[model samples]
Target: MQQESYSQDANISPNNYQLSTPTKEKKQNKTNQSTTIQSPNNNDFYSPKNVNPWKTPKSLLKSNQKQTTPDHSQQASPYGDRYIPLNVSRNLFNKQIQPFEIEEENAYEELLSENVLEIDENKHSSILNFNKQKPEKLQTNKQLENPKRKIDTLPIKVLDAPGLDDDFYQDILHWGKNNLIAIGLQRSVYLYSVDTSKVFQLTQRFNNQVNQIQYTSLQWNANGQILAMGSYDGQLKLWDYNKNAYTGTMNMSSKRISTISWANSNIFAYGSKDKTIHICDIRVPTYSVFQLHGHTQEVCGVTFDGNELQLASGGNDNRVFIWQLRGGNTYADSQYVSWEIKSHKAAIRALAWNPNSSGILATGGGNQDKTIKIHSSLTNTEINSVNCDSQVCKLRFSKIINELVSTHGYEKNQICLWQYPTMKKIHQLEGHSERVLYLSASPDESTILTGSGDETLKFWKIFPSQISNNMSSLLTMCEIR
Candidate 1:
């Protein structure tokens, strides 16, 4: 009856409703019972009351993705549509799978924790028990600041030494302990007083021309009372400084004296172009007291050891000879050649004896060799050698520091300082435009005088003696603190 009543409407049709048989009604009731079964409050089941028909489907949402399209104005002029697939799958996968981390320790922190843990624990324990150990005010141990010992290589004073002969083999400059400097200029020898800063002519040529009577060597006695000068005319002259007068003259058998070194108060040794080393006693200037004959070429350099019993000589024959003195007044027969060094490849002109180490001797070679060799007298063996990279003109050992100084001749014209025994170069003094021919150190071991072939004399404060006082004061202040 209800289906016939609903079918009477124009919109309702009898075909839309089926007559309810007993089995159909029971099946329909069973379907209604299953549909009416309540589900638990979970989002997995789709309920008609909660479902929105107006919402977009998941498939439609996937199809309509928010794409980042390039602007048409920035595209190429052609109008063909191009779709480029993003190649960021690996990056996306990596970002999605990567695990999150908090923080990590660096290598230094790990090393400290592994090795210094015990020390750190001990330090912490000490700090915790510090109050119990001492009740005094907290204080830190002050560090002593040592003043740096610096070499001021700049010339403190530069003076024009006119008419100075540019001879590498000649020793024409000497600085005395009395703050006096005697330099040979042409045929005249000039004396300079460092205290008064005054220079005066000590001697001049009497008959010979300036070129023929050039002074080749100058030396001061240990007491600074007398000065000895050797001339190219094969003559050696003595001057009394206090008296300011020429005392005596000795003739060398037509041989030019290249270098001179004082052995004692009354005795001095000189090297000659005749390949001979002669020792002269001022009391007897008529003849040499002793003569050393080892070199086969011109003897260019000579030095007396600290004890004055050993003499080192270098010559143009690339040889170095060490002679032993008889300690007292003796003739040529008493002195003998102790050793001969044949290590140099060229002429050997520079020689020096370490004042601190009595047995150590240093010799430098000429332009062809450019090498400096150190020999031990006791061992009679070569101890060390250094390649100067230039002609070595002169070598001097420091009295206060365990170091050595050298002047170069060709190419470099530099003065270099080196550590003793090790021979490590400490500093290089550079200023002279020409080859440095002569070098002298002050008696106080604080200043150095250099003479170059450019006819100039430069005074350099190479060592600071006041640094010792500053260092001592710093140590005392630290101790007091």
Candidate 2:
């Protein structure tokens, strides 16, 4: 028997193998000539099951139908059960595989290039069509025209408030609607008439000097006929300026009264060191109508709303309380506190209600907090806050303008005027030698008066009077004659 050996080299030609019978060669030649190579459709080219092992797929052929080298690496068994080694048949497959030429257009690149060309054309066209011209000069006459009036921050009057206590918690000065300014100086209360420019002593006190019974707070009724004064002896005295006589006196629980606010013509509220607020009626001075008890420390500031139906009080406990005055037959059953706010980190002493808007209140904190908070009385929610950068000692809203004025201590030691709603600062008045402890507005809100520990009372002509064009003119014509 003869044994045949297969060559290990893949470059061996077909003739190197033993030749088959002449009849099989003729059949192979006929089959090779008659066979037509059909181009593969998308489905057949992507489907592995449609591939034929005996012949190269149409995807690997050229359009000219040229003869290609036999790829031994791609040649599989007749039954498609096995593949040839790639390393041994690399050269043969390299010659048969042609680099595919992609004639399909890239839609994305075409769209992007079109957009870029259009932008370039538009930009070039705009530049080409643009006309350059010299700018016209503004007329000198138009530039010189001014429409707004100028206001000066100078003080209209400065007077000596002798023996004025340099206390931060006590409110000793107030301006009445009848153009009367009352100030507590030691044991004496003096009334200065803005109309006459005359000062008169309203009361004399012998025990006030010996017992150190200094007046702490002063407030006038709505009609400006009755003046209420609170003394260090915990006594609230009402005096009639017309009659020049004391009308009544009510004793409070605390020895010192810090603040007093007139709720109405007949009712007034006073805050005391006893950490309570007493709402007393001048008609019935024997007993208070109602007593508010929420503050853990001394109540320093108290205010009434425009309608006199609501009251707000601030204390050294860093808390603010709002009370509703219910209309009923009995005083105790008529009023109750609505809400309590504990937002300040320091003592709260300055409080004011907006006269122009309902349910809006402003509160100021002491030296530590140095912030002013605006609140909504209806919902008991804080609307806004401003860091004044100094201790706020007093807050007053203007009746003639939509502005709020605040007196600050420590670093600033000045008065600031802020526009309402927007809270934008309009101006700052800096004339006080020390921290301003009291703030009051004139009857028409055209002037603001500030008292400081410097023991001097200064008046700021803040709002422009409608009757006069400037502050100097108004002061000369109205007060100075």
How far residue 310's Cα lies from its native spot in candidate 2, in Å, is 0.7
lDDT of 1 at 78: 24
lDDT of 1 by residue, 165-224 (tens): 888789999999778999998678898999999988887677645355778899998888
RMSD of each: 23.0, 17.9
What value does the lDDT take at residue 220 in candidate 1?
96
TM-score of 2: 0.65
What is the overall TM-score of model 1 with all chains considered together? Answer: 0.65
Model 2, residue 249: distance off in Å is 1.0
- Cα deviation in Å at residue 27, candidate 2? 99
For model 1, give the 10-residue run with minimal summed lDDT. Answer: 36-45
Residue 157 Cα positional deviation in candidate 1, in Å, after optimal superposition = 1.4
Candidate 2 lDDT, 245-318, residue by residue in tens: 88887875657899999987888899999888888887883747878777889999999999898999999999
Tell me the lDDT of model 2 at 327: 59
Off by over 4 Å in 2: 1-149, 207-209, 285-287, 327-335, 466-481
